[model samples]
Structures are given as C-alpha cells and as structure tokens.
Target: MAKYEALGLIETFGLVFVLEAADAMCKAADVELIGYANVASGYISVLVQGDVGACKTAVEAGVAAVKAMEGGNLYSSIVIPRPHQDLGKIIKRYSITNLVTE
Candidate 1:
C-alpha cells in the first residue's frame, strides 16, 4: 500500500512465529520486509511490500510459515493492491524506519 504497489500483512500470536513468517516471506518472494508491530496481547503483525502477485505469494508464504509452527495461531492476513496514496501518511506516523533500525 502507500507508495508500494501492493502490501501484505500477517498478524499472529507469538513473536517467534511471526518473525519466522516474515523471514520466510522475504525469502520465498521478491518482496521487502517493511516493518512489524507487536501489541500488548503478544500479537505480531508482519508487513511486506511488492507487486500484487508477489505480495499475494509472500502473504501466503508467511501465513504458511506460521501455520507450520506448532503453536502458531494466525489471526489475520491481508493483501491490499493499489492502496490509496493517503495511506502513507498514516503509516508514517508509526515510524517503521525506527522499527527496522532497532
């Protein structure tokens, strides 16, 4: 979404599985691991960006990776193609750059 042609997200419980999913998604497709969010309830949402097809593939790979884990409990998965430009403004408020750096 935002400036990206497509955006994929996988939100699941547990940090380990979500991280693994993110890694697998990146390796499985031509996509970028943009960022991730962790909520107080131990839910982690991993975000990836690329073309529509790539984003779909990456999201499936990510969800599958999480499903392969014994305790993985995937909550939601989404793929947004050609999201509105204004979405970037909201996403920037999250400071995804800082998340990647540290």
Candidate 2:
C-alpha cells in the first residue's frame, strides 16, 4: 500500500503555469508527481501525492509560485487528506487526451 495519506492538486491556466506549479510543488516538499489532467480550454491540474503535511506544504508553495508569476492565474488548489480508494477510478476515467504535457 502507498504510504501517501494526502493528495494535492494545483490547477492553473497555461502550460507555463503548470510547469511552474509542478516545479514548485516538487521542490517545496517530499511528494510524488502522480500526473495531471487538462480539463480543456487551457485549464490544467497538477497532482501530487504524499503525507498530509507535505501535500499541504507543496500546495502552498505551488500557489505562491503561480501568484508570483507576472500574469499567473491560479484557478484552484486542493488538498485531499485520505482520499477515497475509489478516487483512483475517477482519476483514471479522465481521458489520456486530457493529460497535460508540454
């Protein structure tokens, strides 16, 4: 079983912002970059998994980094502590076409 107890999601617009958020999230805490979902119309979500505290820290860092960008616009940031087991099914349903890649 995965040791991760929390999941962090940082949603932002544009590939540039996504990259920035992901970089910040990874650098700020000991988390694993699971994957991302591109929700369409340039909206992307960067997902990370780790301990609750680490996820919180990473999300905060990711949000701060996005806000620091000149034209950065952070749509939302979420921390799901002890996400449901079925969450994986929902995530997997997101089309691969919607996977964010730059």
Candidate 3:
C-alpha cells in the first residue's frame, strides 16, 4: 500500500472541545496520527499517515464532518514531502507509541 502524509489545520470551536472531536474523527478515519502542534494563534496543526486514497478521502470527509458540526472549522493539505520519497520515516519518528505495549 502506498503511504501518504497530510497536514491539517483545524480552527475549532474551542481548543479542548474541538480537539476531542478531532481525535475522534481521526480515529474513525483510521488515520495514523503522527504528531500535532498548536500554532501561535488558535490553529492546531496535525500530521498523519495512511494510504494515499484513504488519507485524502478521510481528510476531506473529516473536514466536511467538522464543518457540519455545531461549531467547527477545518482545512487540510496533503503533501508528498519530497520528490520521490515517502513520508513514512517522519511519520514513524513522530508516531506516538504505547509505552506499556512497547
């Protein structure tokens, strides 16, 4: 399966509330959430990994779903990162592991 990396910017209703919803949406999409960073203003940046088609579809679906919610706003950009290299290495490096399981 081909791997894809995506960067999503979510403008949430509220930090905590929307973050919870984002988490749920990511889980439902089967996205391998690599890492996230809170921007200076009020944007949450996310990095995720998945199959090319699945990731694109999921990202669009997730954004639409969020927009449908009572108070949610989100946008995303899918990036290949490099000319001919996959972003798997970066994804793996930033992936959150379950310490107990590890």
Candidate 4:
C-alpha cells in the first residue's frame, strides 16, 4: 500500500486565497501539505496527500474556502485516488520530501 492513498490539488489566482484554502484543507482533514507551485500569471497550485476520503473532504473544504474569499479566483481542483507511483516524478520538486531533504 502507498504511504498516502490520495492526492489533492487546488489551483487559484491569489496567494491569500490559496493560503486560506490550504489552511482550511489541513484543518478539515487528516492531510499533509505537500507544498505548492506557482504556475505564473498569479496562478498557484496547492497540493495535499491523505486517504481517499480525507483527500476528497480536504479538497471540498479548500474549494469552499476559496469561494468564500471576497475576490477569490479558483482555477481548478482535483482529487486523485490511488495515483500511479510514477506521477511522483512529475511533481517531485513540490513534494514535502524534497523540501525536507533540501
């Protein structure tokens, strides 16, 4: 079994909105913040990992938090359960493991 059963992502336009989402996600579920990525043009993607149900709940909470922001601009959001191990290669730089070791 994988260490984490699911991965959640939330993309938004404002840093403050994303931070709000991240805070909500962590508080609403037993998830780990894997880190975030800036995709330029004021877009950022926040990542979290946990069990399937927790990931889904966390993503929902994050989306709601962003929507609650006065001028929040949410780009997209997703929850991937049982993702392929190889997917890590693509997002390795944003993983918490990378942050810890570096």
Candidate 5:
C-alpha cells in the first residue's frame, strides 16, 4: 500500500460543528487526520495521510459528510504515489521543518 497525503480546504456554514464532523468522517475512513489550521478568511485547512485509495476516499467521504451535515464547501487536493523517500526529498528541498508537526 502506497502512502498518500491530501490537503483539503473545507468551508462550512458553522465552523465548530462542521470541523468536528469532518474530523469524525476522516477517522471513519481510517485517515490519519492532522487536524485543522485556520487559514486566510474563515476556511479551515486539514491534512490527511493514508493509503492512496483510502486517502482519496476519506477526502471524498469527509467532504460529503460535512456537506450533508451543514452544507459543505470543500476543496480536496491529493498527492498520489507519495513514497516516503520522495516526501523526504521534498521536505529537504523545501526546507519544510514542520513536515509532521503541522
């Protein structure tokens, strides 16, 4: 199983409840949700890690669930075939010190 990572920007009518719901949905998909980081304006950013298929499914399901709960506006961007070595190289080149921290 190849590891994959996804960066999603989800917007909800209600921030708190929607964020919690999104978290639950991600957990159900067996995704390692890295939690949310409030970004520009009122959007919340979420990072997820899992198998490629699982990650894709999680992002889709999570977005759907959140939308169902309170009308969701989600943008999901996934990186496929993300091997650890490739990720490490990206981290090194980009000087991404907070690779796993945030």
Candidate 6:
C-alpha cells in the first residue's frame, strides 16, 4: 500500500493561483506536493498526498490562499481519504518524481 493515506486536489482558474495554493498546502500541513495538472484554458489542479487529517488541512489552506489572491478563482477542492488503490495508476503520472527527472 502507498504511504500516503489520502489525496488532496485544489483546482484554480489560473497558473498563478494554483501555484499559490500549492505553496499554502505544503506549508499548512505535513503533505507532499504531487505536482500539478494543467487542465487547459487557464484551469489547473494541484495535487498533494498525506494522512487524511493533513490532506484536509492542506486543502483548506490551499482554498484560502487562492481566495485571498487578487485574481484567484478557485474551481473546486477535495480530500479523498483512503483512495482506491486503482487510483494510484493515474496519480503516478503526476508524481513529483516525474517532474524532477523530466
């Protein structure tokens, strides 16, 4: 099983806001940034992994950060506790390790 107990996602309207949200998420809890996905048309989703509680706190912080940003518009956010193992197949592609090596 993966070490992470939960998966958190924060979607925003623009790159800048998503970046800010990512920063806030990492800083607010013991979570690891799992890189981000650009969903096109200025929409982006930042992912994070950690324990259930940490993921919850991180998502909250991320949403708040985006809301506080001048031009930020949050699309949505979620914390999935104990995600299905099958979900890992898709998440691996967006892992930070891939971002660092590529």
Among these predictions, the greatest TM-score belongs to 6
Q: Per-model C-alpha lDDT, please?
A: 0.84, 0.88, 0.51, 0.91, 0.53, 0.91
Clashes of 6: 0
lDDT of 1 by residue, 1-102 (tens): 445798888998888988888898999899988788886589888888889999999999888988988887999999999878887665555446866664
Q: Which regions of candidate 5 deviate over 4 angstroms?
A: 1-14, 17-21, 75-102
Question: What would the per-residue lDDT of candidate 2 be over residues 1-102, giving only the tens digit for each residue?
Answer: 146699999999999999999999999999988878888999999888899999999999999999999999999999999998878776655534456566
TM-score of 5: 0.57
- Which 10-residue span in candidate 6 carries the lowest summed lDDT? 93-102
lDDT of 4 at 48: 94
Please provide TM-scores, in order, for all candidate models, with all chains considered together. 0.88, 0.87, 0.56, 0.91, 0.57, 0.93
lDDT of 5 by residue, 1-102 (tens): 233444333444346644655576577677665455455666655555666666667666666676565445554434344555555444333231454566
Give per-residue CA lDDT, model 6, range 1-102, as digits (tens). 288899999999988899899999999999988888888898999999999999999999999999988877999999999999999888888877887853
Query: How many clashing pairs does model 3 include?
Result: 0
Global Cα lDDT for candidate 1: 0.84
Give candidate 4's error at residue 97 in angstroms: 5.0
Of models 5 and 6, which has the larger lDDT? 6
In the predicted model 2, the residue pairs found to clash are: none
Task: Give the range where candidate 1 is weakest over 10 consecutive residues by summed lDDT.
Answer: 87-96
Candidate 2: what lDDT?
0.88
Per-candidate alpha-carbon RMSD to the true structure = 1.9, 3.3, 4.6, 1.8, 5.4, 1.3
- Using lDDT as the measure, name the better of candidate 3 and candidate 5: 5
Residue 33's lDDT in candidate 2: 85
